[model samples]
Target: MKRLFAVMLIILLAGSMVFAGGKKESGTIKIAVAGPHSGDLASYGLPTVKAAEIMVEKINAEGGLLGRQVELVIEDDVCKPEVATNTAAKIVGEGVVAVIGHICSGATKAAMGIYNDSKILAISPSATNPALTQSGDYPNFFRTIASDDAQARIEVDFALDTLGLTKIAVLHDKGDYGKGLAEFAQKFLEADSRAEVVLFEGVTPGAVDYTAVINKIKNSGADGIIFGGYHPEASKIVSQMKKRAMDIPFISDDGVKDNTFIKVAGDYAEGVYASGPMDTTTNPLTIQATKEHQEKYGEDPGAFYLNAYAALQAVFNAIEVAGSTDYDAVTNALRTSYVETTLGKIKFDSKGDAEGVGFSMYQVQNGVYVELK
Candidate 1:
């Protein structure tokens, strides 16, 4: 009788172990969508949150990944590097396995070191600074959007080949994202030898007026100007140009992709050209996602939305591939996995940048941004 009791006890203990392991499995996953949710760049942040929310809802409807209900905790970093560092600390402390952003490049770079040391994954939708991924300092960091290096190439090609505009003036906000893009433009622009970088300057981001900068552009005899900054300042520069009756081709990078640029620049926006992330409208998944966004949010998704949603999906794919929430496992799985998201089939290289990069050019036509082929 004593022998029989021992066998039963062993069986009970084995079953309990399996049960406990099952309970601790990938269930109730939580992700922090960190960005400038409430600041001057709020326009960019709102769509990122909305896209994540929409994707989360769809994942839940499909019974969630790993039979778990996913929850998104919105963490606002306000696009400031100092605030981003603090927010990153908070996110790590809160036990999140992944983060979707800190949209601006400076913010992402500030927060990435913490995530790297902790082995937490971060996939940025819009942070395009090449160093963020190129330097290999943050193994856990990845971005859905193309780096500014690719963007600079696109802008230069258009300036030299398409428009044949050679005399160029470049201005930056002196922030990580802006200054990096501006210097990159100048480098490639001068390297080609076909184009002349007439002026390279930095402007204060929140200054009320850009009259002084406008005078510089005018005096530089630059037929075209490339502003490497967010839309708010880019709009001001263009508007000031319009005030001076300067109808030159003012080209900018993805920072000016939002409709806010058009609204702020008013009629002057007519000729302004901005290069944005890939136009994913051709993809069936993107079309469905955009429809769902409108149905759920009562509005259309922004230029950055598809990439944000894909970032979240990439994280989820990693979790599923790892078959658990182990950070190291997911990180390894992400590097090897090819994810077909709204952006189409995308895979990350060793430095965590997308395998290929693409961008779409936009021109303000009739006070609205129209995609230019």
Candidate 2:
């Protein structure tokens, strides 16, 4: 009896010690790839996942980063601000050295506070709200995309100077990204003496119908419309406009500049103009990246695919340059070191925007988006 009791006590002590030590670290370096992995915005986030997977596979094949195999921790936020805070907390809890997403502007804005507090470096491929970096609130935040201010200038200039439009309706989806962009569009149009903004409105996302707003746009006698929302809302509005014979030119921002929008809007998408990351088709790196994606996925890469690929390249390169994942060192290296990516050789500017990254106007023609010359 005494021998048995002593054996039981020893086993219990060993179990308690293991429990007290918490999760044991694996040999691989863990990086979180977070975004709206499911939901309507899944199309936007899944490409980043594939980009990271391909990049990591290439990295490991090249002997890995810092001689350690890299692992990914993917999380889904569904592009909601409320869900994003929780996702951010979960990523911090997972002991990741860095993060690659929180794709939407509102979600990215929500997650940055947590990342800043935890000292984790986060580089977003598509979060473009100016305040995310310009406000000086998130020192740990960086992105590979240009901000909306630049995009808005391109859009307004295209409308007034290129297309010769004088009166326009500016509309948004009532979300952080959509409304913020619409506000900038309104500001620029109001500043331009050649144009007049006939209407500025925000519509509820996922509504069954947008007839009310369509009526407003028609009644305003606007010769053109500028949309500040994603493809889902944009497609619905454009489809409705076409159905009503309101054939004025529809201009939109990067949010609407997606193949999914073209698919959803069908023939109505014809001649719709939107601004997106400038065409990099001529870049050799881009050609190689596209080829790799085609071979791996058996399909054309989706929206923001190259931008996401560039983000991973930038992050891993920064880690290599800094020699460690120290937050200050990695971020400093990001701002100082240039990495050749699908976007060409680029580095982060002081405000976290990617240098040499800018927007270009595109039009949906014959079932595909064609870059305007």
Candidate 3:
């Protein structure tokens, strides 16, 4: 009986040592990929999640961070604000090491408080609303993309100087990102005094038909349209404009830069311009990432998938710098460190915004998208 008792005690101690970190040492760590996985904005959401998957695969092949493979826990929030808040709570509950999303600005904003309180780190690939990082409230939130206001400035300059269109109309989806970016451009345009914004309007998102809004844009007699919304609606508006024979050029903020935009608008999308933060085709790292992405998924990467890959790069780099899983330590490391990513060198400032921000312009020509000098 004494011999049996000693053997049992030794087995229990070994098991305890393996699980001492509150989970089995299975050589795996669970992170989250949260966003609109099943809805219209899934075009925006899917890219980041898929990118995270690809990144994890690569890192695992090279012996993942600290010898633990990354396992993504996907949760779909449908890009709804309330759903996002709920999703954040669930992610935190799952004890995920970090999140790669809450893809839209509204979703990020709604979930920010929960993430902040829980000390759950979140890095969005596409949420560009300034408040997500500018408010200084979401210490745990970070993003790979530039703020909407930053993109708006470049877009406004192009509309006035390059397009030489003095009369412009601003349209938004009324969500946090759309409205904020639209108003940011309008505010700057208002200050310019050289350009005149003839109309400012908001369109209800997820609407099947926007002929009413389309007619409004046509009748506005504006020389250009600046849209602060996603691709689906922007495609409809531009397609309708084509049918109405309105040839004025319109520029879209990054939200509508996906290939789905061209697919939705078809031939009508020709000559329409969209702005993005980085061009994956040109960046050497992005070229490799894109090639790997295509080989794994059997399709070209989404418009912003590189940014998502960069987000993972940022998150993993921070974890490596921190050297531990403690929330505050990891959070502080992210806040203060400059991490190199596929997006080039990325460093977060005091407000948790990425430094060295800029935008790239893209236009649909000959039924394909290409970077505009």
Candidate 4:
């Protein structure tokens, strides 16, 4: 009887030790990385995931935050708003300290309500629709990239003052970012600038042919065309225009600025101009990081990935300043913190938006994106 009691006590103590060890391991500082990991837009999402992975690795290697290794919990929102909301809820349920994604503006907007309700701090690296920051309810939401309004203002200046374009046609994909940017540009061009939007229309995203739209623009007698959409749709439109012998200069927002656009559009991408915050290729740090990324991953990093890296840095900086994993504390710290990231110094305004940054214009030459003056 004595031996049996001793053995039972030993078993109970061993079980208690196992449970305690599990609890300690589970005390990880989890940062959720949500994006369209599996979709036609996977190129955009995958790079963000890779960037977050790199950031986590770097953070962990340096003894991590608050003496605990950072852990990344990535979720695929598939670039859909509903999926994004669900993913945000799941991340919150998993007790992640913060979130760094839902790359598309629509997805970010969808998840905003949940994040706000849950008091989870979410910083988007790529979502650029003006509404996300301007919306009054999203106090916990933040974005690293400049808004479409800024991009539009810069592109409009280039179109009128630099390119000397008088008449232009604006086309958009009808997505949140696309339509927001197109409408914003149109308003600015018509009201503030000498440029006239001769033709404005929405195109169905993922359509293989845009011959009808191209013909409309051709007949509209516009000297230039601005497309507000991603590379896939923009490439198809440009390629189709080439088939129709449309020689009008093509301009686009950052959505269409990617190497994949050049590859898909082939020679047609040459002379295509795009406006965004300076391309990652132009930044020395980004250039070196791209080389390292290529060496490690066998491919160059995408534009959004660099933005994600900056966003992650901002979040971690806020975490360190707050000195605790509490979401509200970190959120407050983010608003008050001055973080120097890959994009330079970042300071947020009351609206949770970056301040006083300008956009850079780039043009494709010989299948490579080069910054244009």
* lDDT per residue as tens, model 1, 1-373: 9999999999999998787566546447878999998868998888999998988998999999888998887899999999999999999876677899979999999999998887789999999888898898998898888887887878888889888998999999999988988889998998998889999999998998989889988899999988898999888888788888988898898899889888777887788888987776698888888898999978878758888988887899988999988888888887889888889888788888876446878888898778788
Error of 1 at 340 (Å): 1.8
Better of 1 and 2 by lDDT: 2
Write the residue-wise lDDT of candidate 3 on 282-364 in tens digits.
66777788888889999998856878888888888887898766777777887778876778777777787777545878889
lDDT string for model 2 (273-361, tens) is 99997878899999999999999999989978999999998999998999876678889999999999999889998888888788889
Predicted candidate 2, C-alpha RMSD = 9.1
Candidate 1 lDDT score at position 283:
87
Best by lDDT: 2
* CA lDDT of each prediction against the hidden true structure: 0.86, 0.90, 0.84, 0.83
TM-score of each: 0.63, 0.64, 0.63, 0.63
Candidate 1 positional error at 175, Å = 14
Report the CA-based lDDT of candidate 3 relative to the real structure. Answer: 0.84
| Candidate 4, pairs of clashing residues | none
Considering every candidate listed, which one attains the maximal TM-score? 2
Query: Which regions of candidate 3 fall more than 4 Å away from where they truly are?
Result: 1-21, 24-27, 154-182, 185-280, 360-373
Output the TM-score of candidate 3. Answer: 0.63
Q: Candidate 2 or 3, higher TM-score?
A: 2
lDDT by residue for model 4 (51-143), tens: 888888878999988888898899999999988888988998777778888789899999988988877888888888777887767888888
Residue 148 deviation, candidate 4, in Å?
Answer: 2.7
- Pairs with backbone N, CA or C atoms under 3 Å apart (clashes), candidate 2: none
